[model samples]
Each structure stands twice: as C-alpha cells, then as structure tokens.
Target: MNEILTKERLIEARERISNQVKRTPILTSSSINKILNANIFFKCENFQKVGAFKFRGASNAVLSLNEKEMINGVATHSSGNHAAALALAAKMKNIPAYIVMPKTAPEIKKKAVAGYGAKIIFCEPTLKAREETLNNVIQETNAIFIHPYDNYDVIAGQSTAAQEIFAELNDLDFIIAPVGGGGLLSGTALSTKYFSPKTKIIGAEPKEADDAFKSFNDKKIYPSINPKTICDGLLTQLSEKTFKIITNTVDEILTAKEETIIEAMKLIWERMKIIIEPSSAVTLAIMIENQEKFLNKKIAIILSGGNVDLKNLPFK
Candidate 1:
C-alpha cells in the first residue's frame, strides 16, 4: 500500500468500522458561528473515552490486523493519546501492545500507557531515535508496526472521525482539522471529497510549525522533523502520503501563534467548558483569529483531543 492515503481506502475504512466507538456530539454554537458569519459545528472527540479520536484508528487497526500479526502484537511511538489508545485497544482484543515514547513526554501520558498494561520504551526526542527504537522492538517481537500518521491503514482509520463528523452534520460547508502530521486532515479531506464533495477541507497548524502552510503555498514539499510547536501533538512532520492528500484536497491552511493558542485554551475552558491540549487549542485559535473568514459559513472543526496534563494548564 502507498504511504499516503487514497480516497477509495478511506471509504472502505468507514464501511469496515463495525461498532460505535462513540457518537460524539456535534455541537452547533451559533455564537461563534454568527460572530464569524459562519455556522460552526464542533465535533467533540474530547468527550471520547480516552478523550481523543486516536481511539478510532487504534481500535480499527487492532481489529483489522491479521491473526498472526495480532498474536505477535503491535507497536508504535506516540507522545500521548495514541500510545494510550493503542495500549487500551490491544488490551480489548487480548493482544499485547508495545509503545515507544520520548522521555520528555508527559508523565501522565506514560502512566496511561502503563496503566493499560503496555511495555513503554523511552527514547530521545528525535525521529531517528523513535524509528531505531521501534525497529528494534519490531525485530525482536515480530510485532506488526502501526504507524501513528504515516501508513495508509492508519490514515484510513483516522478518516473514521470525518465519517462520524459529517454523518452528524451532513450539510457542513467546510471542515477544519488540526494538522499535526496531517493524518486527521488527510483522512478527513479524502472522505469529505468522496462523501461530501461540496464541503471544503482546511488544515489548522501552529505558526511555529508552518511547514504544511509553507509547503502548500510554495507548491513544494518542505520537510521538518520534530519542528518546535506548543502543539506537541502536532510535532510529527507530515508523512509523504498525508502531505500529498492535504496538498490535493485541503483548500487552505490556517496558522495560529503560541499566544493565540493560549487564549484559545482559555476560551474553550470558559465558553465550551472542555479541557483541550495545546494542540487542539491551536485549531480553535485559528477559528477565533480568522473569525471574519469562518463567519456565517456552515463549518465544522474537529476538537481533535483533550489530553493536556492538568498541572500544565495554560501550557507554561
């Protein structure tokens, strides 16, 4: 399979997911919508069990794995939600799970993975470290490798979020998703293109990590591994496959600064009464900062995840 996701496989993934992971609420907030002159819908994946949509991909990947591969188990390196999701999903299937995470990753996240009974491997904060460590684990156990955002199957799984969001509000004029490595954005774009052709898909990224925006604008692939952003969840450089889909389907990329992200966190707390990590807050910042553009349009923003460390409120 190709590294990037395709429209056909995204459709197949939507069909293959059998159970309701969660019918997360699609809240219509006319206030923000009206202020921007855009009708806004928030897909509350924060309310999900693990408080993130990573569960969709983890669960799908676990179920779809070949029996032999399932027996050998699965492994991946993720900072937080994805690790917890993989561990829990594998547990549900009665398979072992191995997670690799940077030592600097939040202790809360590490605890979550351990709590789910996964062996946690700590590594340095670099792509080379993550890949080399993951490779060793794979070779030793013969575990199937499930990439966080790079693989076609993973992207197809993430697309399930878009399927749910659009299913909840079929007439949205556009969709906005947090673009870390572009898994969610690519998946959503492919699915939206197939299922809701009229709906425009836009990606939201931090100004500090503007490779997606720059790459799209420059019409060239810009590679940056471990680019610095308050959105640790958005730190992964886009995969080659995900980059292609975002380049093709996403209409525009919105950039928000670290300060705007802090304000966005405060807004979600005060108005929405939801806790979101800095990564998710970046997307909200985009909406508020560019209110004039989003205003009065039928729009949906995937509140991707709520995995912030409670002690790090306001992101230090």
Candidate 2:
C-alpha cells in the first residue's frame, strides 16, 4: 500500500528498541466487560517505560539519530510524559536532552523530567511561549528538534503498542486510543490497518479538547485554544503529519464529557485496580457513551499513560 508509514518501518522500530523499551502487558477486566457488554482488552501502556507510551517514540527517535546528530543531542517542548521519555531515552544513549516546559507544569512532571537529567527551560504555558523557548534552546544547543508526535520515527515507534495488541488479539473489532497531538491515535490507525485490516481504528478525546473530532468532521486540521480538560495529555492540537494520517485512516473520533472521563477513570481504579490518567480514561468514556454500538464486540483500548498527579486529581 502507498502510505507514509509501512509495516516494515514499525517492525524495524520494534527490533531496534526491543532491548530498550518494555512490551507492556495486555489486561482484560471481566467486570468492565460485563458493564459495557463488550469483550474489551486494555493495552496497559501506563506500565510502559517512563510510565507512559511516549518512551517508545522517544527511544526510537533518539536511537535513529546517527553519531553526528547525537553530538548536539535532541530537544523538545513538553510539560509531561514526553519530556521525561526523551530525557531517559537520551540518557540511555549517553547523549544530552534539552526539555522546555512551562513553569506552571505540575511539580511531579517537572521533577520527573529533571530526574531524567534533561536540562529544563521554563516558559509561559501558551503555545507561542513554549515554541519560542524551545526554539531558543535549539538555537543555543544546535540540538535536533524531536517533535513529540509529528516525526515519522516517533510515529513508527508509537505504532508498536497497537502492533502488540493486534499480535496478541487478532480479532479485535475496534481499537481505540486517546488523541492529543494525534500521535498515539495516528500510530494506532496505521498499525491497525496494517496488522488487522478488519479492525476499525477510533480516536477518543475529551469533549473539552475535541480538536481531533472537529478536524475529523470538518476534513481539516483545527487548533485547540484554551482547552480546559482534566486530560492534560490531550490538550495539544494535531500536527500536519498526524492530521493527514488521521484523516486518511481513522474511522472516527469520539469525544467524551468531563464527567464521563472522570467516572471512567474511577471505575478503572476501582475495578481493574489500575491507575490511568484522565487521557487514558477517554477511550473507556467513549465506549461507555456508545455502548450499544460496541455491545458484544471485541474491542481494545490503549490506556495511554498513568502520569496523573495524585494531589491534583479530578475526582475527590
């Protein structure tokens, strides 16, 4: 097939980073299945290295760079998991990583990034400010800018999660993942299409951050402005590359309300005894919202991450 990403690329990524990243487990909850009336599998990326699936992408991006590119190291702007993932990946490769984070970022996340030995530059929380700060860091260090979700290497790396899911369960009727900058969702779409052509790929998002949904329906990329959602990982808008992949491959974008997301998060904690972030809960919220459509079907949900700050939880 004529595609920007290929099965060979994803296979290469998995081989390259096999020793570097973890093949997180796939979990099934009988209670959850009974509640939704669908056979559901949860690809627990929360158990992934660096506590999120971002590690897979970061490891691939860092490892793909040659010695010359490694000299100056890599840099990116992120307030949460990506920063930590890139920093840890760079450390594993014995290279430097520069991360630009907003000063208002949660203390736990800031600490995690710094703990990985990345040099952190703080800026305002706005996109313009983050971009300006990241650009400045790049200029000063001459580091390669490894965008969190836009780069082909990163997408290929992220696809491995969905690839694993399909490998473990070939009969999934639908594979759902949360959409932020559309990295995970786009990667899932690509891998789902390649590995299990019969399975539909769905992108889930918080209603508060429904840029992907709007973009899907409008047939164009749309930006999220001042998104006020508990799912911090899904606040960013999609990149051009991700937008293209989502538009071409994703079957639909489902949005969940804030209450639904929180409730789903709580349910997972209560029943599955897993701590998933609000972004991960978006997938379950979408399924719960459209129960009848998925009833009795086999579905797989990508639990994107578990990096929520317990101190600032959405649920009481």
- TM per prediction: 0.92, 0.98
> Which regions in candidate 1 have their CA more than 4 angstroms from the true location?
1-8
Per TM-score, the best of the predicted structures is 2
Q: Per-residue lDDT of 101-151 in model 1, one digit per residue for the tens? A: 988986788888999999999999877899999999999988888888777
In Å, residue 217's CA in model 1 sits off its true spot by 2.1
Instruction: Give all candidates' CA lDDT scores.
Output: 0.80, 0.91
Clash totals, every prediction: 9, 0
- Candidate 2, residues 123-223: lDDT per residue as tens digits? 99888999999999999999999999999999989999998898789788999999999888888898988899999889999999888899999998888
**Candidate 2 wrong stretches, greater than 4 Å:** none
| Error of model 2, residue 184, in angstroms | 0.4
| lDDT for residue 307 in candidate 1, whole number 0-100 | 80
